[model samples]
Target: MLRNSKSGYGWIAITFHWTMALLIIGMLSLGLYMHQLPQTEPATFQLFQLHKSIGFVVLTLAVLRLFWRLINPSPRLPDGMPPLEKAAAHLGHAGLYALIFALPVTGWFMVSASPWGIPTILFNVLPVPHLHVPAALGSQEEAESFFKLLHEYGAYLLIALITVHVAAALKHHFISRDDTLNRMISAAPGKTDN
Candidate 1:
């Protein structure tokens, strides 16, 4: 199933959800791990490059996933939910989506604004150029510091949001006893319902 149905997610959405989940979680873990390592080590530099590569990949995937969501309808929230709860759910989801895009863009901006002039070679293969910043942003140092803070704090926000998302899903599945989680994990056999 390529498109989403009224009841459940299609293959594409499910794939995007799981793949991006893994990548985002992995990226967050990597970031925390790298923070503890001595920056002068060669391995630390390599890890930073790898982190940048994954950030770009996440950005690309986020673009596609968002496009898909724009075109396809998402599975509806449980019918029994209260109006206030539903609104909260929607707002929470909005936050999640916002972080998804903001984190990567901020990371890219941070790297581009760095004074070191380090070229971002994606996966050490493809050369990703830095963003050409106008003088209006002041010195590169200030801009880099600004974006770096955004990226770092954005990561922490993402983690907190993900916790809420997962808890809500589990609540829907276990407490609510609905097919909410199941529908996302797998569609009914021969089901066109996304």
Candidate 2:
């Protein structure tokens, strides 16, 4: 039950999916809240640190999840699904994974290029290295602005993808009455294709 089956997802896949989903949602909300605070507020710094810490955690998890996914292939789509639908599912998953990697990296670059030059002490415990951005590219302000825009727009794209992902899952479960959602929720070994 730990490995994926042709018919359904296993415990590991389900755990990774749900855990990352929850963390991403939390990170998005936190990012929005932190963005609204004035730079001078003491709480703003604390929140930014928390956001960066969690972003690093998400980045690590995303790498692990992608590795696991490569080793364990996803469950096959239910029979009778249109070819277009299957293709859309694949594209949606790819987009999500890309965003998962991108959002954190952009955030890290944004911090590294910060005009303030503040160190990122993750969770107030361990120090994380800042990414090296070449001085020749532009001013620190310019680099920060570029990465900040990327990070923000990337998050919005992620939100849009998540909405489509959820709606599709609901459609599969309710409209199609398929095992797509059930496979993720249940640990029971699915029926094997002979």
The lDDT leader among the candidates is 2
Task: Give the CA lDDT, 0 to 100, for residue 2 in model 1.
Answer: 72
Candidate 2 regions off by >4 Å?
190-194
**For residues 1-194, could you state the per-residue lDDT of candidate 1 as single tens digits?**
77887777888998999999999999999999998999999999999999999999999999999999999987777778899989989999899889989998898888899998889999989998788766777899999988888988999999999999999999988898877788778755323333
Residue pairs in candidate 1 whose N, alpha carbon or C atoms collide under 3 angstroms = 5-194, 8-194, 9-194
Please give, for residues 35-118, the per-residue lDDT of candidate 2 as tens digits: 888978888988888999999999999999999999997788888999999999999999999999999999999999998999
* Candidate 1 wrongly placed segments (more than 4 Å): 189-194
lDDT of each candidate versus the true structure: 0.88, 0.91
CA displacement after TM-score superposition, residue 158 of candidate 2 (Å): 0.3
